[model samples]
Every structure is written in C-alpha cells, then in structure tokens.
Target: MEIDRLTVRFGELTAVHDLTLNSDCGEVLALLGPNGAGKTTTVETLEGFLSPTSGTVRVAGHDPVADHDLVMARLGVMLQSCRLYSAITPLEALRLFASYYRRALDPAPLLERVGLTHRRAIAWRKLSGGEQQRLALALALVGRPDVVILDEPTSGLDVEGRLLVRRIVAELRQSGTCVLLTSHELSEVEKMADRVAIIDGGRLRAVGTPAELAAADRRPEIRFSAPAHLDRAALASHLDATVTQPEPGRFILALEPTPAAIAELTVWLAERNIALSDLSTGVASLEDVFLRLTGEHQPEAKGPGQTP
Candidate 1:
C-alpha cells in the first residue's frame, strides 16, 4: 500500500493534507492520531469509499477508486462497527460472508482461529461485545486477503481476546500479509507494528518504528512517583537538575539518568525519608510523543468496559 502526497477534502475543509506513507508485505503499519485527525479519511480513500481530492493512492499497485473490484478482492476490512443480522448465528454469518469471495477460507476454521467456535451457534445479538469483535475479525480473515485493514481490532476485547488478536496478527505477518491498522491503543501498536505513522490535523507528523520515534526525543529524563508535596526547588537543588511535578505524585527530572545520578537520588530520598514508589529513566513513551505532537490534553480515564 502506498499513499503519495494524498489530500482529501470535504468542500472547503481539508480533512487530509499532503500525507505520504507506505506499508509493505509482511509488515504492520499502525496509524496513530486523535479524533478528526484525517486517519479515517485516509483509510476511507484507500478502501475506495471516498475519492482523494488531490494526489494519489495505490493498494497492491492498483488504484483503489479506479480498480475497486480488483482491490476489494485482495483487501479485507474489519470495521470498528458493523451491523450484522440480530438473529444470525456466528457460523451462519461467516458462511454468508465467505460466499461473497471466490477464494474464501473455510468458515469453520476461521471461526476457530478467532476463538469463536464455542459461540458459533449463538445468535449475533446474544454475543458479548468481545465475542462480536472476534466474529468480525474472523469474517475479515475468511477471504484470505493479501491486505488487511483493521480498525480498532481489539476494541472491547478481554485479555484473552486481545491475546488471540495478537496471535492472529503474528500469523498474518508470518504469511506475508500487509496489515494496515488504526487504533488509539498505543501500547498495542508499540508491540505489534513494524512501523507507526503519527498524523495530526490531516498531516503526517512522523513515521518510524516505535524505537526510532521514542529515541528521537533527545531530552531524556528520569521520572518517578513519590509524595505529592515534595519541594520542587529542594529536589532540584539536591539533584542539580530541573524538576517539575506534572501531576500529583508524578515528577520528572530533566537530567541524564546515569548510575551516579540515580544513586544520588536514592540517597537523597533515603536521607529525607521520602518513599519512592517508582523510578524509571528512559526516552519519552509513544503516548508522550503523541501528546507532544498532537498538542491535545489527555482525557480522564474511562470507566470499565469502555471500547478503547
């Protein structure tokens, strides 16, 4: 898959600016961005659901819009939300979707692969959200597609369901399938993606492997969690580094976390009777990089059972 200077607009609003990216066979490329960041617009263009206002897009060397049928044959899409017949059984739904493809995988084994064999006889509406997501994934694989586009593939999944998705993705990579993914799950992206593309305001901000992007942060710092009311000035004086508490109980020290520095910190804390619950020295995380690039405040934690 290749997007070269791709631009998509809706009337006067440019939803996607000049964005260029490519994902190769046997590779998973994750697209990361906040809402309304043009990730959906770009994916829709690749799926032939919308035409690019300017520039070009090619999937498997064929234009998605101009050669929709050819591209559709090799592409499997797992949307975040798709309505299935309320009463359709998982087995029945897979068989029905399988019939649409000339060269489809066996629905039974596909269902098994997604860990839905036990629930195959249950009605679609009777399945839990996680079960439904697994069934949707099975449907995507039934076509044995060369290119798979997964949207929030693990949303609402439990730990076991998430592990199943990871295993399937690993299998896909081993089979030399090109996978394009979009998700807000940064940790999963870090684990599964060969490369990650960060986009904001419809423009590509950065594209690199997780390590590469994280290592680009030259400002390495030591981060720790301790008492909330630690004297910032006193700590800074002790460590001879800049210190700030971005949040209650979380503090950042702008200094290279060398062994001597860590030892000094531990000694200072020990002398002051301050209990350090956690300490780490590293480059910024993907989430931190994302927040810096997108300039958006992180939302409060979600309640249990939230999709993301």
Candidate 2:
C-alpha cells in the first residue's frame, strides 16, 4: 500500500497535510497518534470510504477509489464500529461471510484460532464486548485477504484475548500479509511493529523503527542513587545535561552515554565526596519518543506483554 503526498481537507480545516506512507508485504506498519491526528482519515481513504482532497492513494498497485472492487477483494478491514447482526451466532456469521468470497478459510479453524470455539453457537448480543471484537476479527480473516487493516484490535480485550491477537499478528507477518495496525498501545507497538509512524494534529511527526524514533531527539539517560541529596543548582553548573530528581537522593541525567561523559560524572561525584550507587545508562524507549513527539503524558502499560 502507498500514500504519496496525500492531503485530506474538510471545508477550511485540513485533516491531513502532505502525508506519505507505505507498508510492504510480510510487514506490520503501525500508525500511532493522539486523538484527531488524521489516522482514521488516512486509513478510510485507503479503504476507499472517503476520497482524498489531493494527491494519490493506492493499494496493491490499484487506486483504492477508482478500482474499489478489486481492492475490496484483496483487503480485509476490521473497523472499531463494525456493524453485525446481533441475533447471529459466531459460527453462522463466519460461514455467511465466507460464502461471499471466491476462496475462503474454513470457519472451524478460524473459530479455534480466535478462541471462540466455546462460544460458536452464542448469539452476538449474548457475547461480551471482547468476545464481539474477536468475532469481528474472525470475520475479517474469513476471506483470506492479502492486506488487513485493524483499528484498536486489542481494545476491551482480556489478557488471554490480547495474547491471541498478538499471536495472530505474528502469524500474519510470517504469511507475508501486510497488516496496518492502529492503536494507542505503545508498548505493544514496540514488540510487534516492524515500522512505526507517529502523527499529530494531521501532520506527520516521525517514522522509523522503535529504536530509531526513540533516538531522534533523545539523549542517553543516566540514573543513579547517591548517599545524600545533591544540590540541584550546583549540579547544573558541573554537568552539561538536564537533571531531574524524582526522589530525595535519586537523580536522572539526560546526556550521551559516552566514555568521556561517564568519566566526567564519576570524577565530579568523587570530588564532592558523594557515594553513587545503582548507576545505569540506556537510551529512550518507544513510549518516551511518543511522549516527546506528541506532547502527551505516557500512560502505564496494561500488563507485561498485553497492550490496550
């Protein structure tokens, strides 16, 4: 999929401005942003739901709008607000959509993969929100599409449900399927995404691997504990870095983790006759980059490997 110099305008407000992005087969390209960041608009344009105000958007080398039928056949979209028959059972719904395609996966295996085998006969209205989301995922894959667009697939899911989706994403990547994932889960994006794109206020902010984006505007962080509280004003005069104290005797310094920098810090601390402990140095994380670029506070991760 390719979006070259694309822009979307709603009257006088520009929802997207000169945005260009792409996703290669066998790769997961994660689109991340704060609210009202034009992520949905960009995805909808590629899905052929809305026409672009300017520039080009294509899927599988075909114009999404001009060749809607061809693109529709190759793409599977799992939208957040996907409408379904509340009275239909999971098994019945999967089979129903399978019949619409020339080739489709068997409904039985899909039900098992999504962990909905026990609820196969339960009506949509009887299932919980997470269960409904899983059914929607199965419906999207029933057609065996080449490109899958998932918007907040893990939203409202329990621990087991979230793991199931992560496994499915890895499986899709191994099968050489292009997956466009959009979610607020930065930690999950860190683990699964091959490339990350961050946008804010309808403009592209940064794009790269998680590590690359983290290093874009960051310094290595040096965190240490001291025997006593260091004077913040005097420390500023001795170090060429930004310092923060979250605790009485703990200090975090933002600077390059080079040999010279470490030597300077050690020498300075020794001259002051202060004992340092728990010293560590590392670069920023994807969440750190997200916070810096989008100017938003980082929320706590849902769990160790689960993301929402």
Q: Which candidate leads in TM-score?
A: 1
Top candidate (lDDT): 1
- The local distance difference test score of each candidate is 0.87, 0.84
| Stretch of 10 with least lDDT, candidate 2 | 298-307
* Residues 1-308, model 1: lDDT tens digits: 99999999898999999999999999999999999999989999999999988899999889999999999989999886966999999999999989989999999988888888899999999999999999988888888999999988888999998888888899999999999999998988888899999999999999999889988964667889999877766777666677756557877777788898889888989998999999988877787677768876422222232333
As a whole number from 0 to 100, the lDDT of residue 82 in candidate 2 is 73
How far off is model 2, as Cα RMSD?
Answer: 7.5
Clashing pairs in 2: none
How many backbone overlaps does candidate 1 show? 0
Clashes per candidate (backbone, < 3 Å): 0, 0
The regions of model 1 sitting more than 4 angstroms off are 226-250, 267-274, 297-308
For residue 240, model 2's alpha carbon misses the true position, in angstroms, by: 9.4
